[model samples]
Target: MTRLILPLLAAAMLALPASAQQAPTTPALNLQQNMLLRCSAAFALGQRLQQAGAPEAAGWPPLAAGGREFFVRSSAQLMDEAQLSREQIVTLLTRASQDLAREGQLARVMPVCLQVAGIR
Candidate 1:
């Protein structure tokens, strides 16, 4: 079951629009949004794993903590690169979480996150 999920997740990510894969750059901000975006997805996946009583729930805290740290540490760089405020990034994270939940993609979360973290 797990073996099949990674490819599907990769395909799903690939299917997203190029704009969705990259953040809009403004005069003040010019960083690629991939890191933040992947972290956001991982964070959301962690939340879903926890809610679904999945065994992977045990990994959520570490994932969430790592994501938070990455976001905080890179916020200045990301903000400067994309002209996005901290609040805006938070909003993006929330929206990402909500979207994942709404899409019923819980089964895909764990494997995607593991891939995001380079664990699998």
Candidate 2:
């Protein structure tokens, strides 16, 4: 997933495959779908953390409430770009986040979550 997303999201370094014919802002359905899927997963984690009342870490930069909103709004764009319904988007996000949580992968992915949430 990072292989695909890093290319697309890494500060204008977009070198999309033929399938990703659309512009970076709007990837085609097959345009490295995992990029948005994984990002949405990270965003889902952010929402969960917010709902759980997790405080800002003492050392890390403070996480603003708007970060979650950014992810939520971005999810809509993801769905629209891929022509997916809300339920489909929700399912993808839920499954990815759940799998990561079940496998105790949060520690590995929190940095990614923070990045996707635009924390830095």
Candidate 3:
């Protein structure tokens, strides 16, 4: 029993590193779906605000909020979408990962998209 246990433990130890070294098998989902979802939410919010007789600027809050969410979600989705095309994926992943390191970039862009969407 002791001899068997030792070999089993050794095998398990060896296998662990090999498994860890393997590239991730599962691909992540992309940002497009998330962006669409967020946009939908923002649009809905804007409609509600308008119906409630809130100022035009009221939509800005939710729109801006959604824009930021969309950007982040889109960035992640872009990373995932890259899987469909390996070369493009590498470039996008690198860019997206790098951009993520910069603080407030998403927030900055959010208002612009929201503005374009007529949120304010």
Name the top lDDT candidate.
2
In the predicted model 2, the residue pairs found to clash are none
Where model 1 places Cα greater than 4 Å from the true spot, the runs are: 1-35, 44-61, 74-76
Worst 10 residues of 2 by lDDT: 1-10
TM-score to native of every candidate shown: 0.48, 0.54, 0.28
What Cα-based lDDT does every candidate model obtain? 0.51, 0.52, 0.42
Candidate with best TM-score:
2
Instruction: Write candidate 3's Cα lDDT for 38-79 as tens digits.
Output: 343344334444446666534345443444454445445555
Model 2, 1-120: lDDT tens digits are 222322234222233353332322333456446655765565555455544566622333434454446556667777777877554554455556667666447556667656756676
Which sections of candidate 3 miss by over 4 Å?
Answer: 1-28, 56-120
Kindly state the number of residue pairs that clash in model 2. Answer: 0
